[model samples]
Target chain A: MINNAGPSNSAAVLDEGVGPPSLSRLSDADLSSMLLIRHFEKNLLKLFEQGFLHGTTHTCLGQEYVPVTVTSLLGDADHVFSNHRGHGHYLARYADAEGLLAELLGRAGAVCGGVGGSQHLLRERFLSTGVQGQSLPVAAGVAWNLKRSTPGALACVYTGDGTWGEGVVYEALNITALWELPLLVVTENNGIAQSTPTGQHMAGDVRGRAAAFGIAYERFTDTDVTRLRAALQPLVEQVRHMSRPLVVEFVTHRLGPHSKGDDSRSPAELRAVRAADWALRYAAAHPEQFERIDAEQSRRVEQVVAEVLARPLTDWSPR
Target chain B: MTAPRVANDLNTALHRLFAEDERVILLGEDVCDPYGGAFKVTRGLSTRYPHRVRNTPISEGALVGVAGGLALAGDTAIAEVMFADFVTLAFDQLVNFASKSTAMYGRHLPLRLVVRCPTGGNRGYGPTHSQTPQKHLIGVPGLALYEASPLHDNHTLLTRILDGGVPAVLFEGKVLYGERMFTGGVIDDLYGYDLADGVARIRLHDPVPPDCVLITSGAMVHRTVEALRELLLHDEIVAEVLVVSRLYPVERAPLLSLTGPARRVAVIEESTAGGTWGAEVATALHPHLWGTLASPIRLIHSLDSIIPAAAHLERQVLVQSGTIRHAVKELVHG
Candidate 1:
């Protein structure tokens, strides 16, 4: 099918959001979850500056609404395959902020016993890999199994626009279409892949790619969780009951660097990205609920940081 | 009744696995009814278990990935990469994802996945079509390497892989498919085999003390046995033949006992020399077999070059029985 939206553009603003959805109407639970990821990511960058963290991390700052809303659409049994920048994906599913921070800090109570670090996290029903383009096939296979073993539960995988270059992505998509596995491939197309922008890397748009395989394609140019969920209710049901594979691409922005201090964008472009942040938009629309919940989530993340830091380092040995 | 062909036995094993369990899935290119498989090892399978056996597009990478995913989701996934040479296309999925998924993810997930590759050269299929790439996947962690030989039962081997519950790569030599199954504990009418140790130990029809042992696997076992038979008859030198199916995680006790009696042993394979499985076996055995009064563990392999399409050149590039005979005669006489 052709793209449900107009000519696909990766950098289209959320002001392109349908129904002009208001942020003030969003439930307090949803607002808290998004802010929890927001402050958690900001704290991680601060940790690196303060010399408290090692290696590197990819924070899903501007793209927090993708996982927050997508995970809400899924049930507990549905497998969530995350990518290198997957802190929001994990937090949205498990809500275990302390364990995730411990994983990054390599502390004793780390989620993966401190072995997976920030990128390669593995919890029950949720997994994240540091590699690109490999998770789609794995998720497709799991979806095939879920179709047989546990009907109605689907497999959802998160990837970036940069991952379209991987041949395995097409390979997985081809069979997923041929076999009709219940798979939801969510692409967080933030316009730029690492430092190279999408236009430089991708030839045609993602909609055409999905059309080539006959997979259902949907695009979101906004961060309206409630409205998006209401709109997606019937489509998500089709993915589960009809055993159809869907590609939901979110045209969002990377408010933070690709990894850590690797933003190659001009200063003007970076300022534009900051201005489009859902946090800033939410503050402008719902000041009372946004200020209270945002501060509370920020304080909660700081407490998690302090508590996870004091713990001893993880000493892991395989059996 | 005629003896079963190697391909038929494998086909039967796949059918049996699908019949025994509802979760067993076979994925491959042209695996379904009309095409069966390139070598017909999966013949008549999709007809019997249509939903369980699937025909995939020409996608080796995703083929292995889907198999790994099915295995991760608690299904016995068996995938076939048409020819062994193409196994290289699925190397990353095999090593990085399928192999690592077992242990790297916080908890243990039993990936009952098997990738079957029709390996080795002799039929003049040329460089890309007839190469043995099993050596590349031999030592990957959490992954097992196996081969199907005329002397072994496919059902037993496939069952063992499933029972172990780890991802495995089973190499089926291209030339071995048409060969008759060496059944009834006898081989080539000149040697007898003992499968007591889960690996075949073939010796003369009657008991005789041997001077050295030739360690080989898969289709190459036939050549090694023929060389040993010739060494006993013409050269008056008796050399034992130890045929291994499970190539990786080499078992020490059985190997030492089989080769220790002769004190002189050589590892033979179809892969080219430099970084071959023969070298790994020789290195692994030398330390334990030290001071046993032998020159050194010998590694007999094909020349380090691409296999050519010409039959004559292929024979020269691959290790022939004469090469094995020469290596053993030198070890015995000198």
Candidate 2:
């Protein structure tokens, strides 16, 4: 069992806007996925401005490396449960940029037939719901099933730091630990929940909460996708072999607003958050591959947007 | 077997389910040995299928949510709520998560999950512990609702629901746990009924066009049955009794056929009168039988308030046998 991660630590980290640990270069695949999500979200905000999109969307801008690294370790047999800010999670797993864009535009060929909008997505071995804290138990159940039916497979669920306030998360953690179910709980602790900072909304910390349930807890303060993947490989293997639950907390940053145009932070705080952005670090480490892939993925997203926007609306009707 | 009570029948059904299907999992508070659930419907189930029958903590929402996940992974899960009132604690998982998971995805995910909610208040459990909360779940898409009755077989209902692969809520009447399962012949040695499409229709005196029809379900069934018998014997007003178990997405075809002979109808329920299943049934049946009905279908429900713990006060708050009798008489004459 783990003890308190202590208080005001997140505040110290968030207020300072200290940059993440300096790391080695990332692989082409990892950099491409990170840039792809970056282009997707940046394009979504612009599309909102251009009248091609309506409704609200939560963009995983600076936190793209979290899913891009974690999902690279999952297999087709393993399940992934994503929260509201799940575009990066989906793109990291399947790279269905056109399907996701079509979904956002409610166009034909959209994933989920345009029923599940920006916050909801479904595909093989993956599901996302807009509501917070509801996916934990479902993911635990999937993990329980995997332990029995699939043997070596595991279920990974992504949640925001704010979602820790939901009682269902603790309930799920208790069961996952008690049953020794193969579940990986990934908390993208971007230091804020919607408009509220973590210090105001959460108490103690996620590490203490996971410890209370006798689950193993790990933390990531760096954005090097390759290094994070190397560290996660053994942890994920333990989850499969022992069929025990694990909580991986990524103390990352959110460069964008909680949603479109909802940044309640000041310029100083925003600058602090920018310090944690991996794009600058990735570019600084390997400028050539970073520049080439960024431009390529950016153009790829532009073409995806144009093609998806031109398609007809989906024909799915309610029963 | 004929003398086995509703609880015994349910226990037997669960035993059969566990013996036959290894993938069927049970999760709830104290559902294992020495507890066998709050209603004891899960008695002796865990001893046989130890791995499948589990004792969950007091987390209603997560248990239901987890059950949905298990079912989504090709396992049939039965989640038991200690009492019907606690089902409220699991509303988000049931209504939002499990309900939407069925169709929100591109395709329908066959979620083979059944939440057994032991409901109704006849044991003086009072406000928070006693309630027939099925009305709260009325009309939720992809959520099938059923209730235990003296007329229906638990094994048949559970088997059929699991076979269809739709997520369901089986509202077991806590009051019916000790009552003997009705097999055939005269019910309460009073009336004869026919079972069709999981709905039971009782004719009190003879097969004549009823002057008043009484529609009710679950723990309220016997009360309505006794009321119809009284109406026939004393008032000589032949009445019909339609006891429904499947409460949601009301089957119009079978209901219309079963209710064809009904003239003045009244929907009697225990869960107070306000946007209820009774109201839904009346609305579904009204326009189709508009001019045919002597009057607009009446909804007879308990007084809109919390269930009291005291016996007399509880009686005043809940529907009774006499309550159904008096309501039907008013529907026939008033």
- In terms of TM-score, the best-performing candidate is 2
Which prediction has the highest DockQ against the true structure? 2
RMSD in Å for candidate 2, one decimal? Answer: 2.6
Model 2 alpha-carbon miss at residue A15, Å? 9.7
The CAPRI-style docking tier of model 2 reads medium
In the range B215-272, model 2's lDDT, one tens digit per residue, is 7787887787777778888988888888887888777777888888567888887897
User: Tens-digit lDDT track for model 2 on A1-319?
Assistant: 0012344326326433453567677778888888999999999999998988979899999999999889888999999999899999999998899999988899998998888888788898899998899999999999989998899999999999899999999898999999999999999988888888787778788888988998999988777887899999899999999999999999878889999999988887888778657887778878999999999999999999989988999887666
Individual DockQ of the candidates?
A: 0.66, 0.79
Please provide, for model 1 over B58-81, each residue's C-alpha lDDT reduced to its tens digit, 9 standing for 90 to 100. Answer: 999999989988988889999999
- Tell me the TM-score for chain B of model 2: 0.97
Model 1 spans > 4 angstroms off: A1-7, A13-24
DockQ score, prediction 1: 0.66
